[model samples]
Target: MHNLRRIRKHLGITQKALGDGIGCTQGNVYHYERGQTLLPEMAGRLIAYAARDFGLVLTYDHIYGSAQLPPVAMAEVVNRG
Candidate 1:
């Protein structure tokens, strides 16, 4: 499971705000945060948009454990970008 809700909240952003920034709806954000949906590609986009638009940097280690899976690595690239 991903800690997207926790991390986004820790970054001081509401679900709606995160959704708005990522071109998705709040329900989609909820699904992502709750692990009901798995949008790995969108997750990368969201992470990048969060850092570039909201100045919130979320590393792969923050969301997933240090497993270094392909998706997690992409998330790292998004976080760094």
Candidate 2:
């Protein structure tokens, strides 16, 4: 089962807050939590790191279940902008 909602609630932050933390909208957070749209691995790691900056720890298991998160290349991401 997806656990973004659980983790967000535990951290006492709203969907909008988490979305802002990760540069997404509240709608995106809602869909991601409900499985309407899959949260990409890179984006998941970004969110995890953002949450960490806020003193919360999240992981692939917490966000993407038992599956492993694929490695992300910072170069490609930086070049996209």
Candidate 3:
């Protein structure tokens, strides 16, 4: 579950419009925005769209509610730092 609603609102778009952009139903967008369920593909598409159109980096954690990195990715990031 994620706070997609907040993002959508921030972008001044309706649920139906976001759904249309994401290829989901308005009901699905409503539920997803309410943190009921969010598909990864949808999340990815949303992030890409936001980045491309609005220059926003809406991260999966920001939307999906889990910002925790996997151990391997975290380790790699840490090593680089």
Candidate 3 residue lDDT tens string, 13-75: 678877776778899987776667677888898888666655556787867675532222233
- Against the hidden true structure, what lDDT does model 1 obtain? 0.66
lDDT rank order: 3, 1, 2
TM-score of each: 0.66, 0.60, 0.68
Which scores better on lDDT, 2 or 3?
A: 3
Consecutive 10-residue window with the lowest summed lDDT within model 2: 72-81
> lDDT by residue for model 1 over 1-81, one digit each (tens)?
777776665556678877887788899988887777545777687679757765556666656654332222344435433
What would you estimate as the lDDT of candidate 3?
0.68
Candidate 2 regions with alpha-carbon error over 4 angstroms:
42-51, 66-81
Output the lDDT of residue 1, model 3. Answer: 50
- Could you give me the TM-score of model 2 versus the true structure? 0.60
